[model samples]
Target: MDTPSEPGQPTRLLFLGEENLADGFRLIGFEAHPNPSPAQVEQILRQLQHTHDKAFVLVDEALMREDIPQLKRVRREGGRILVMAVPSLQGPTALSSDVAERLAALFGTATLRSE
Candidate 1:
């Protein structure tokens, strides 16, 4: 959690995933962490809900299963941190993303796989 940014400062961007992705995100100015555990993710989300004015958090999709109660609560609470699941470097991910689901719902599943 951090103090509200000055009038000119940009909101923080955080990425939690494998080292390869973390390195790239760091190059682009995100506060990146490599291979964070589920507990750590919960802690970060909880902290963000309480203090920061706003942030962008990209999580390793494989690490977060939507069923976790803590995660569900954080999302439901409408925190300042915008949390999103992203593809990780660890093999193929079985996890699906909200964006993908929404796109499929809007355009139909056939359109998604057609590309």
Candidate 2:
């Protein structure tokens, strides 16, 4: 479970999931933020600009369905940033078929992730 910071300490990870899931991290012992929109993601990313201290950046694929292009762009210009798209608890899955196909076409590769 993740415990809240006392005063001055670095956040463990940058989470971009549903705000409701914040408790899970709290119970386990990690800090996280829930960002459910492209604007919100951009805002958070800008806020953390030049700070590569985040252990991870987690995003909900469903929430970010419309931002896959932007996400791909960000992913390509990678640094220490690790972006993952998780599925929402009570929503459609975030497999991103279109993005996956596009990626395959661009790279001329096989299935991105075979089942």
Candidate 3:
């Protein structure tokens, strides 16, 4: 980890999404941004851009299509700050996860169960 303020500090994990997911992530030690506005999201992204520490930012799948220019630029640039899209806490939407499908393929239907 490397930063102007704190050299050799530990890498960070971030969860930028809704409140439902934020509380749980915060408890697990991730820096949580619950239901942030577009501007706030952009600001955070900009801040992360400068800090030269490896980090994982877990963004809600729904926010993947954010119209923020900074986010668009970050996605286009592709840096050490890894970004991942996860499902919302409210459950799967149109952008549903394929976890069930993958699990079924690996373990077979008899071993898979639905909620």
lDDT of 3: 0.74
Candidate 1 residue 30 C-alpha distance from true site, Å: 0.8
Deviation (Å) of 106 in candidate 1: 4.5
In angstroms, give how far residue 60 of model 1 lies from its true place.
Answer: 1.9
Position 80, candidate 1: lDDT = 58
lDDT of 2 at 55: 42
TM-score list, all predictions:
0.70, 0.57, 0.69
Candidate 1 C-alpha lDDT tens digits along 1-115: 3566566657779897777888999999999988887777777776766664478888777655645555667555655567777776556544456677788789887665522
lDDT of each: 0.71, 0.59, 0.74
* Winner of 1 and 3 under lDDT: 3
- What does candidate 2's lDDT look like per residue over 57-107, in tens digits? 666665556654546655666654566666666654435545676887897
Residue pairs in collision within model 3: none
| Candidate 3: tens digits of C-alpha lDDT, residues 1-115 | 5445355667689999888988999999999999888898898988888765567888786776678788777766776677766776565343322554577678876555323
Residue range with the least summed lDDT across 10 consecutive positions in model 1 = 88-97
Q: lDDT of model 1 at residue 36? A: 81
RMSD per candidate (Å) reads: 3.6, 7.6, 5.6
